[model samples]
Target: MLKENKYCCEDHVDMAFDDFLVEKETFPCLEKSEDSKCSYCNKKAEYVLKLPS
Candidate 1:
């Protein structure tokens, strides 16, 4: 069981979520990142992409 997570900024969350859907074959659960940074642009992450382990 591997837990996967990706932090995305508001600007790129849509694109990142789209990719996540394609990869996971289902929607990812969105959460607040708090202090996490975006994996794409390194901006302060506003969305956290997570899937069950």
Candidate 2:
């Protein structure tokens, strides 16, 4: 898997999820990382978004 994107809030999660779902068509693995920023915002990321490689 690859850390495709990072999300700080649920609002931004849906867009990433939809893109992932369309690309992979499966549930993704989740993780949390340190010092990572949200892919769609300036806030620090709370959830690590992984996409199957």
Candidate 3:
């Protein structure tokens, strides 16, 4: 199943951190679409930030 990440404008500017109940093989959930729109605001994303834990 395609997990849906909870998006909060206050927490981030672009894509939100995916709260995957299951374990993922990858890290740094940040992403960008071809349209260049902010996944949270639907506006132009200033930049993409990748933070891995």
- Best candidate, lDDT: 1
TM-score of 1: 0.82
For residues 1-53, write the lDDT of model 1, one tens digit per residue. Answer: 43488789999998889888877787788988899888889999998999854
Q: Please report, in order, the local distance difference test score of every candidate based on alpha carbons.
A: 0.86, 0.67, 0.43
Model 2 CA deviation exceeding 4 Å by range: 1-10
Give the poorly placed runs of model 3, Cα more than 4 Å off.
1-11, 14-35, 49-53
Candidate 3, lDDT over the whole model: 0.43
Clashes of 2: 0
Please report how far candidate 1 places residue 4 from its true position, in Å: 0.5
Regions of model 1 farther than 4 Å from truth? 1-3
Q: After best superposition, candidate 1 residue 9: deviation in angstroms?
A: 0.6
Q: lDDT ranking from best to worst?
A: 1, 2, 3
Look at candidate 1 and give me any clashing residue pairs. none
**Range of the 10 consecutive residues with the lowest summed lDDT in candidate 3:** 14-23
Task: Give the per-residue lDDT digits (tens) of candidate 3, residues 1-53.
Answer: 45333323433542354432233434444454333545466665544434454
Residues 3-40, candidate 2, lDDT per residue (tens digit)?
55545445577776776677667877777757777777
Select the stronger candidate by lDDT from 2 and 3: 2
Q: Pick the candidate with the highest TM-score.
A: 1
